[model samples]
Target: MLSDQIKTKCTLPHSLYRAQQIKDFEGEAAALAGITLYSLMERAGQACYDVFNTHFPDARQVLILSGKGNNGGDGYIFAALAKNAGLSVQLCQMGVPDDLSGDALLACSAWQAKQGVVEGIEQADFEKADIIVDALLGTGLSGALRPEYQRLIYKITASGKPVLSVDLPSGLNADTGAVSDVAVKADATITFVGLKQGLFTGRAIDHCGQIYFSGLGITKQFDSLCSSSVTRISYQDLSDRLTPRSRTSHKGFFGKTLILGGNLGMPGAVRLAGEAALRTGSGLVKVLTRQENQLAVIAGRPELMVADFDLNKIDDSAIRDWATNLVIGPGLGKDNWAKMLLDFVLASDLPTVVDADGLNLLVDKPAWKDTWILTPHPGEAAHLLGCSISKVEDNRFSAVRNLQHSFGGVVILKGAGTLICDGKQTYLANVGNPGMASGGMGDVLSGIIGGLLAQDLNLQQAATLAVCIHGQAADLAAQQDERGLLASDLFPYIRKLVNP
Candidate 1:
């Protein structure tokens, strides 16, 4: 039976490294768990063979593309196994076999004694194979794709055969998930040792068509290493955080949430936010919208207490008396009236969850920065930080950290792997999917965080729970229909997850 630690270690949270790193990390741990690293490698090769056979059992004529690393060593081992299994195996070297050293060379010698070998890859040979094992240029790649490897990648991409990449799809940045000019587009990528974060996001999603992970039976060793606090939250886990209610519980137990947004023509922003706050279990929800939106606020959702007029209509004294914890900047336009209201809300003593246009206005004023959670997408974060989108993408860890330092509060940088950085610590949420790249997603997330805040969670706790639950809900919804999953798809599920 696989232990939970081993099951978890099968998917690495970081990038790929030299097989030696895998060996060093897993060797001692596997021994303590009553296994060996070499034994793990053998199991890895066997897993690859099993996957290949299960997926393409009739592909008797096989082409094993080997590099000069242990990844290639894995390929050589599998090639020998395939040959023994009565398949016509051809060992094609992207680099010369003579250049292979260490375990890779040992595996190569074993293959040479059995299967036929070739020094160079041929286009005709590639066309003739029913299946191709892409072991070329595994994890140690950096900078750009090598020219020779680039050409091979292009050819393999054009081949249209079943290509199973060993470890990561070569030429892709393992840590950042960035792909250079060329990368092998594989049918299935069987990643061993650990699942690199790159495999699920950015260009990786396209290059790696199907992802399969194998622990190679050394999970306990890898888990022993210290890890970043970041994790992918699923619905099952999020639901566990919900405080089960007793029949004796009353509304007074939950705190009030004040939603301050909805400029002149955008009352719907606060409308949705207020409703979401109520839905998320805030005892009382209030909406401070433009006076013109008073009727709409009351008509759209009568359950909320709508504060009349813009923020300017009410003095700091009045604003202070109204809200407990505030949520600002959902559909807040950049008009002067909206700006003044935003300033008043920012200057207020209440803890705030800043989102949408509120963040835009805060970036402009540059004052009101302490214990406020600033939520922004890549473009918005770039604007606030005054950097290009590429710079932010190049290093998200730095970008999020910079935001928290400048703003003096928790920062939720929303994107593929949404980052919640609280100045000292950082958490990466890997729950969401591509289908969630639509409008109104941030709006919902802001409201969720606001509700948590109203429920008396600290700024950091509110942000963490809100972001995790949001992504977790999206992940759960995706299980039903990944292609059609939307931001609103998480609404009902979010309520269930938070209140379970």
Candidate 2:
């Protein structure tokens, strides 16, 4: 119920930031709405206290690691509240309390007036504490940790205290989720006011364990104030976009989908895609593969029709006539046969999703066209966009936006936070888990999107729905256990979700 309520009321980080940006830009508009930045900060601190107490009810001794920023102010406020609530609290200041400015200084002054002791860098054993509140750094932190803060962070990590980070963890870059040097590892992180983008992607997710969000009394109207370039995919969202068909609907009502890949040794790629399309509600599914693997394409899934995609015999018109929506990639090799198949698909005007080897071939040839969805992992997306994989990793939002604008089609920049872009609009998918790091996952996703497209969903809708459902299935599969989970394991769950 908690997670469900979060999904329903709390939005993805990017959307939350967009809303806050708009509210901030309005200047006095927030005041008009009975909202103030200081009030937001107080609410943030209070929410952090609530989450900490809820997670560690038995923890009596609390240590608050505070910086000289508004985040520190939050910690100061929280420490005061904890003390008032009859919990023993300690403030280990990373810097001089006199160095604090703005609301943070005011908060410290308030706490000091209340007889709170502010101590300097001392090796007070945090292991003896019940919980540690990390308010040492805020989203404004960039680059490496300063020397004093570095020592404090290292000590906190080594202390083995159960940590509850206020907003983002100290030393972790909120925009990139990249750690400059070392970062505080928290058991739970409560983000407030606006959700930072970094907490959900890259290394941030691992560092920020058991994440929670509190809007801090910000109105929903603030959402319209800013525009976010990211979105998240959740299990609860799958059925809303992918409802079952009407009782009177027939196979003819859905469109035809074609899977164009599966080289000599990779018949499973096309097979997985074909089966996924069928399961995802595609009316008619066809596999256009090499003649050598014609029988292999329909191995277990005999319902799908197999076509021998021989270049010498097949023409563009013939391929066009079969697939209303095409998914090229999966096991597609970067050979001449694969090239011819890709050329045929690109020339046609049908909606298409290109992934895996299909992306590799397109990078080599470098053609620009629309009506396609390129689902590339970081490496593939990097190659296509002509940048280093690290650069893409550092800034996924920018990389995905570039891919969409340059390629002139919807782009599914697949990774932890899978980005979906269709020129003007961008959506971020926060579904799935680290368990989905296994092989053949991209193949399954490609097929799901192709199938959704065949069912007459528009390109944008199909991409979002398919990505959400695919990640959601993997998330569910991992519930049994994540370590040994396989890509094929998601099939039954996918069928249940789309058809149920």
- TM per candidate: 0.87, 0.93
Residue by residue across 1-500, what tens digits does model 1's lDDT show? 22232223224344333334554566666777787545665676777787676667778889888887878888888887888888887878875888888767777787788744655775337778898898887676868887888888888888888888888788776666667678888887777776665665455657876666777766546767524444444344445556777789787778778887787778777887787787788888888777788789889779989876534356756656756788888878888877877767766777788888888886678763666889989888898899998778766667888888888889998887777788777766666787787766787788888888877788877887888788877877888877766666787878877866
In TM-score terms, which candidate is top?
2
Cα TM-score of candidate 1: 0.87
Give the clashing pairs for model 1: 11-195, 12-194, 12-195
Local accuracy of candidate 2 as per-residue lDDT tens digits, 73-148: 9999999889999999888776689889987888888899999989875745587788889998867576667887
| Location of the lowest summed lDDT over 10 successive residues in candidate 2 | 1-10
Model 2 scores a C-alpha lDDT of 0.80
Candidate closest to the true structure, highest lDDT = 2
Each candidate's number of clashing pairs is 3, 4
- Once superposed on the true structure, which residue ranges of model 2 sit more than 4 Å away at CA? 1-14, 18-30, 35-37, 233-235
